[model samples]
Target: MIISEGSLVLFFFNSDKKWLIRIENEKKLHTHLGIIDAGSTIGLEYGSHILTNKDKKIFLLPPNTYDFVMKSQRTTQIVYPKDYGYIAARTGLRNGSKVLEIGTGSAALSTFLASIVMPEGHVYTFDVNEDFMSIAKKNLEKSSMDPYVTQGIYDPEKIGQIRDVDLVVIDLGDPWNYLDIIYPSMKSGASVVCICPTMNQLENLATHFFHGGFIDSDCVETFIRKIEAREGKTRPSMRMIGHTTYLGFARKVLK
Candidate 1:
């Protein structure tokens, strides 16, 4: 499809250099490679190419949900993409699924979930920090995910409004503490994932899973290292994301 005015597009220079932008008229984007005339991308089809001011070729690609997740603005550490797929698959999250996100850091994960469950499903995300919530709202709006997301400030009384959700994702400091409160709101066979940056937290959360009528509990941590591929010089990238967080996954069961 042609890149129309105000259309979101991805300018891919390399694995490390990518820019997500809306095609606004008279917009110029400066990069290390060269200056990109954002307006020039209009009418260009995805998979085509654009030339920078230095005559460097940049790939014009379609922006996907993952693109928005990585490009989302943030004040805090957002959930990494590596963990998103695992959580979705483990929880069976799909179209029309309802998700309760306890910590709306940057809305990166929220945007991804919203994209999958769009036009039918919804994500109710809560956070105590108003400034972070404000940033997340903008990120959600940028990805057009605001329609499927319900942003709310954290309040004990307001949480009761969420019920029968398919998935519960907790990213707070002590996710295990909220299990009792959200247990009634989770559907039978629903799944919960807690993000733990430390082993102690993971062990603590896992113990609660056993005592809280959750079955099939497991915890996993992932690391990703990009390979710098070049002719006769392909090797593992020195810069890598290691040990971002541990994901504790469990499914609710009725006693």
Candidate 2:
């Protein structure tokens, strides 16, 4: 497995620490282990180990969307992998599914969604903040998922312009505010997933979904805990990723 140029690579120091960077021969990387000449990595096989000047060993590994999200630059809070996984699985998003993503904060959700619905489908992500969109564009470009996503810098009030989407994902403080606009644009039986950080928002969202003619509504909070696998000392990790946000799911049902 040759490490290709422009490929995202991970230098794992340990389970807790790693560096995610694009393979650029012209650049050099500086870390606590020491400085690494990037040009030297051009022909190295993945899983190969290299020793730094300080005699620290590092392993080259393939990178994934999760790594990209964790390492990508962010101007706002991002949706965690745990929540995105649930959204993907529950919504049954697949290749060729048109997705409408509201609130393109850091593009983490869009990046993951684009990876799933590429070559045949597309994601139209909307945000009012041009600055946020600019950062998001960079992230998508870095992930090589830019071709699969269409980002626009427009006010959320203009969401009425979007139409015929298979899935609608809302990442905002008040998802209820857009329900009216989203209802007409969504296809029948289409799934709507909302991420709310507070109970006040959840209550408003659930109420709005019910009255807005969305059925099969369910709200769930996902928590993930990792367990240590050391022999004779295997136990749950002391620190676990917990309480990112509450997810609300519903299906469009025209009255």
Candidate 3:
């Protein structure tokens, strides 16, 4: 397919450096590799190569959900794909599954869930920080997942309007405090996932889940290390993101 305006493209230079860009009619991207005429990419077939001014070869590839989430403009720390994989598996979220997300940081998880729950389902994300929500809105828009998402600044704990949510994802520092507030909005058999950054938070959340209207509680911490998959030197990358956060999963049981 031909490249077009607003199309997301991935420019791969090497394993260490790759850029995700939104194509525009009149734009130039300056990088350490070279200056690339973003407008010149129009009409080029996907996977085509363009030579930069500095003779650097730039290969253009269509970006996927993972690329959009990773390359999204970040105002805060985002949930990495490794954790997302576990969350998705634990929750079994899919198309037509309504999701409620608290603490829409950078909207990475929001975009991921919105992409999966398209055509029939929606994601309602709330954040107290308007600036963060604004940044997240732009990121979701760039990924074309905004249509499936609803962004708001109201606190999910105090909001009385949301109801029948299939999944509730709590990304707040004090997720346990919101468990009582989130319980009423979720439907029976729905799952609630919490992202905790510290052991203290996880311990508190565990205690809350035990007392709250929840069952089958489980917790996990995800670790990801990318390997250099090259011939003769295929091994794990020396540097890796060892710890991001802890994830706690539980199912809401109806009274």
| Candidate with best lDDT | 1
Clashing pairs in 1: none
- Model 1 Cα shift for residue 236 (angstroms): 3.2
Q: Tens digit of lDDT per residue, candidate 2, span 1-255? A: 897778778888798778887888786788887976655678899889777678788889888888888888999989898887788889889999999988999999999999998989999998867789889999999888999999987555556777789999988888888887788889999999998998889988999988998998999998989989998999998998877889999999878
RMSD, one per candidate, in order: 1.5, 1.6, 1.5
Candidate 2 clash pair list: none
lDDT of 1 by residue, 116-220 (tens): 788899999998788898889999999999999999988767787788899999999899998987888899999999999999999999999999989999999
User: For model 1, what is the error of residue 17's alpha carbon versus the real structure, in angstroms, after optimal superposition?
Assistant: 1.2
**Which scores higher on lDDT, 1 or 2?**
1
lDDT, candidates in the order shown: 0.91, 0.87, 0.89
Each prediction's total of clashing residue pairs, residues at least 3 apart in sequence or on different chains, is 0, 0, 0
The best candidate in terms of TM-score: 3
| Higher-scoring candidate on TM-score, 2 or 3 | 3
Worst 10 residues of 1 by lDDT: 153-162
Model 2: residue 195 alpha-carbon error in angstroms: 0.9
